[model samples]
Target: MTTEEIEKVTERGPAASAGVTRRLGPATGRPSEASVLNVFSHGILVVWALMVGVPLLWVLWSAFKDSNGILTDPWGLPTVLHWENWSNAWNDANMGQYFVNTAIVVGGSVVGTMVLGSMAAYVLARFTFPGNRFIYYLFVAGMSFPVFMLVIPLFFVLRDFPGSSLLATYHGLILVYIAYSLPFTVFFMTAFFRTLPTSVAEAAMIDGASHTRTFFQVMVPMAKPGLISIGIFNFLGQWNQYLLPMVLNQQEDKYVLTQGLAMIALQQGYENDWGALMAGMMIAMLPVLIVYSIFQRQVQSGLTAGALK
Candidate 1:
């Protein structure tokens, strides 16, 4: 063979060998391991979805059935819609009143938490001061503290709150909710605030804007995603809170949705109004589901934005 042909063959020899090795690589178990991992992960996700979704769907459909129907065929779909179940839950079960109380308490608590938590987080993230790390670590420590342990002390504090007993009052519950939610809120917002650009805030300051003005106008708008995300989390938590309201608010008239639901469940042994109970459950859940659905994208972005930054 010519020298050119000999050289060409040598080049092709290694190339062909590498091509064969590539083709056989997958058969050596690497692809199977990856496929198995994918299948396992997907299976776990599907199971988790079912665990969460099935109960919710069951409650939804059962809300449209009568008590007898619900008890007899728990898994069956409603053949006829019992619209009165909703009205009954609203009126007879006092879910409307409970809902209003929840809205007031949760609304106020969320507003207060965002306002206060954001301010604290921004300061911690942007400013340098004595005890800054101490204060930040203190907030972080609060997250690890068991809430149930504080309930007794909180009870007394609110009870003898100088002016009057805060027990069974809207404002009182609002305050507790704010405190309970603050730790994580501060932690999350602090991290998010650090991820934000300091340059914009500096520019705002140079423009003769006050710290307050810069935060509300510039920093706040920039941190909108984090705010919405934390707000939703606070709403869900405070809305569903049973322990605090139960211990703090004993007045039946002042019961929140969680308390009212428990009341309804307790009455079930006597009244057997399973359908109304399910309907009320749906009532309490709908707001949470709706809020989450509306802000789903914002929540996802907020959670991931800091990590990306």
Candidate 2:
């Protein structure tokens, strides 16, 4: 008999298909619990979205209002859209210079972190060598050291860094950021590297590919999801960095977004231009928002795939 006829016969027989199906869990019978959970999850998500969105929207709109209008009626909208707030924040407040400085620092550090961190992680995950675990543990150990603990020693280290003082230089700050960012990056990427299939890498090796070629051409492409996820994480952390630059980059001309914002706030003191401050914040936030939105899918997929491994 055909598959359909066999099924029909089985259903008609004393050995019933209904009984076999009935023996399965509640999931086979009904989705009431799943429905409830879905509704609950969606409700929580909506609440969380509002909690995040409301403040951001407030910041965006408040950037158009004058100081008095913002202070006197906090919830009210701007009577006239003040586009000059952005211009003033960018040029007059020196946020433009800070934005460029932040971009340069973050871009260099993120690229360095991803390259070095990925190499280290790939080796740790794939190769079996003497002191491999020891080296991996050493990198992992750096994560335990807090920024506060490092600040004092780092200050002296930068002050007397070999040939020259690395105290306030761009390269100095980039090096510091890379060093500080590596521990976590190495840890995360190592786990992700382990999750990737080794068969393709092995096949590449079998086909006369050198380790470097196989890694760069084969493994790296395969690990795109993980790399993109970790890259974004590193970028966000480096871009939003405040304390490191504040401590190391003391030059006013080399000040980053965070430092510039702090200076603006300090300079504002009593007579704060809330609108300009809001405009400055929006400028800083826009890039990060765009990045996350673009890579949201990759990030979700990467994290889940790593977790499954």
- Please report, in order, the local distance difference test score of every candidate based on alpha carbons: 0.88, 0.86
For residues 171-258, what per-residue lDDT tens digits would candidate 2 score against the true structure? 8989999999888788888998998889999999999999999999998898887788888877888899889989888999999999
The candidate maximizing TM-score is: 1
Error of 1 at 170 (Å): 0.6
Going through the candidates in the order shown, the clash numbers are 0, 0
- Tens digits of per-residue lDDT for model 1 on 1-309? 266579999999997787577667758677577668868998999999999999989999999999988988899899999989999999988999999999999999999999999999999999999999999999879978888999999999989999999999999999998888888889899999999999999998999999999999999999987888888777777888999999999998899999999987876663478888999999999997887677776656644543564
| lDDT for position 239 in model 1 | 87
Query: Candidate 1: where are CA atoms >4 Å away?
Result: 1-48, 297-309
Q: How accurate is candidate 1 locally (lDDT)?
A: 0.88
Error of 1 at 190 (Å): 1.4
